[model samples]
Target chain A: SQQGEEDPQALSIQEGENATMNCSYKTSINNLQWYRQNSGRGLVHLILIRSNEREKHSGRLRVTLDTSKKSSSLLITASRAADTASYFCATRGIKAAGNKLTFGGGTRVLVKP
Target chain B: TAGITQAPTSQILAAGRSMTLRCTQDMRHNAMYWYRQDLGLGLRLIHYSNTAGTTGKGEVPDGYSVSRANTDDFPLTLASAVPSQTSVYFCASSDEAGGNYGYTFGSGTRLTVV
Candidate 1:
């Protein structure tokens, strides 16, 4: 089942701009993860933030998780054409739950060069 | 190591034909999973295995079957292909069951049933 739901199904941004997307989940989680998928390709892990943490960063990507709200957001700074792809948010449930990762619909970002 | 490899990158099959999508992970990860991606449905889990010789059903396991005979392989089979099953399938693996680590995904298999 889909544990998370991403808002703004699609977004358009120009090169050197920033793109941000939000994801909200319905249940308690162990962590939240972000993935990127190019057209016709598999998803690649971008970042992961544990439930106890509020924010983390990797290169140009920043992820913030709010356990209280069961929501998370991914921000890409100074985006480029190469960043044009579908970004997905996934949640890993508590240990008692299966090790499965539930994914959201994903936000398709178009970076115009 | 090849994190994960899915066979028949893409396929077109008849509605009643049976097909098996293969997945192999050379990373020797202890956890593996299968997911299907539709246009707007995102990715739905079909099956998962925490370790060799153990398997579990995921959200959309109705017409799908999975087997993890060893640490490196997990295959998904469709008893009878249907138009509704026409979607891109992805195989992923993580270091452990709790998913404290990030997952590595295979390129994916695009299956089309008519």
Candidate 2:
């Protein structure tokens, strides 16, 4: 079974609108990271928020982690057509060995011009 | 930095044949991982190596094997392909700590077992 799961399998919005995606995990984690994947390409690391941190910002990306609820959310401000892609959330467990990242079922976002 | 590279962008194999997918990372990351992505399903870890000469199974390890003979290379093998195994295979690398830096993924290899 997958440790992390993303909600809202797909989303569609206008170019300038903000898009939000949520992820929930079942175990205690040291950190949570978000990634973007374009068609035919590999995933690109976007932002990582530690368990102790409540919120983080990078460019137009905003990530919030609520360790108490074991969930995280990614908010993309002023989205663009170029930002249309699949977003995935990965969880790194605190006591897990190695650098294993358990990914969730991604949410595909489509931005219309 | 070349990052991570995977070979045979796409491949088609018979159900009973064997094949090897190659992955190499120029970053010299201490940890490397193999994952498979299917439609509607996120990437699932197949195998991983924390360091040279040590490999461990991930969420889904059946029908797959990996070897880390050197720091720069990690290859995954399928000893008898099945249609159920057809999916996009990704190779990723990360620093020793694994969590803080996130992961760097390869371009991915699309495999089809018929």
Candidate 3:
């Protein structure tokens, strides 16, 4: 089942611009992760933010989690044309039977050079 | 490291034909999963195996089957292909079950049913 849903089905931006995407989930989660997929290929793990943590960062990627709101945001700074891809937010809820992850509908981002 | 690898990167099959998508990981992860991604929709789970010899159905498992006879391999089989079954299939594996570690996904298999 789908637990998280991303906002802004698609976005287009110029290279070097910052890109931000939001995800909202239905239930409490142990942690939230963001993944990047290129051209329908396998996903690459970007960053993960635990429920207890409010924010986390990796290089140019920044992730924030708000348990009270059951939402999260991913920010990619200095976006490049190569960064154009689909971003998905996956939630790992405490109640998940076996640590299964529920992925949200991804946000398609296009970085035009 | 090889990480996760999926066989038959792309395939075209006639309706009613049966095929299996192969996934393997060198990570020795205990949890493996099969998910299908359709246009405009998020990836939906088809099946998962928490460990070798244990399997469970995910959200969509009607025409699909999975087996985890060993830790390194998890294959998804389509008993009978249907037009609606065409999508990009991804295989993922995690070191542990919960959210402790991130998942490693395979390149993906693009299957088209005609």
| DockQ leader | 2
Q: Arrange candidates by TM-score, highest first: which order? A: 2, 1, 3
Q: Write model 1 residue lDDT over B1-114, tens digit each, in one string.
A: 667999989999999999999999999899999999998899999899998999998889999999999999999999999899999999999988865788899999999999
lDDT of 2 by residue, B42-109 (tens): 89999999998999998899999999999999999999999999999999999884557799999999
C-alpha TM-scores of all predictions: 0.97, 0.98, 0.97
Off by over 4 Å in 2: B97-99
The alpha-carbon root-mean-square deviation between model 3 and the true structure, to one decimal in Å, is 1.1
True contacts kept of each: 0.74, 0.81, 0.66
Error of 1 at A111 (Å): 0.7
lDDT of 3 by residue, B14-41 (tens): 9999999999999889999999998877
The TM-scores of chain A alone, one per candidate, are: 0.96, 0.98, 0.97
* Separate clash counts for every candidate: 0, 0, 0
How well does candidate 1 score on lDDT at residue A97? Answer: 53
Query: What DockQ score does model 2 reach against the true complex?
Result: 0.77
Off by over 4 Å in 3: none
Docking class of 2: medium
Which segments of model 1 are wrong by more than 4 Å?
A: none
Error of 3 at A98 (Å): 1.6
Assess candidate 3 and give its TM-score to the true structure: 0.97
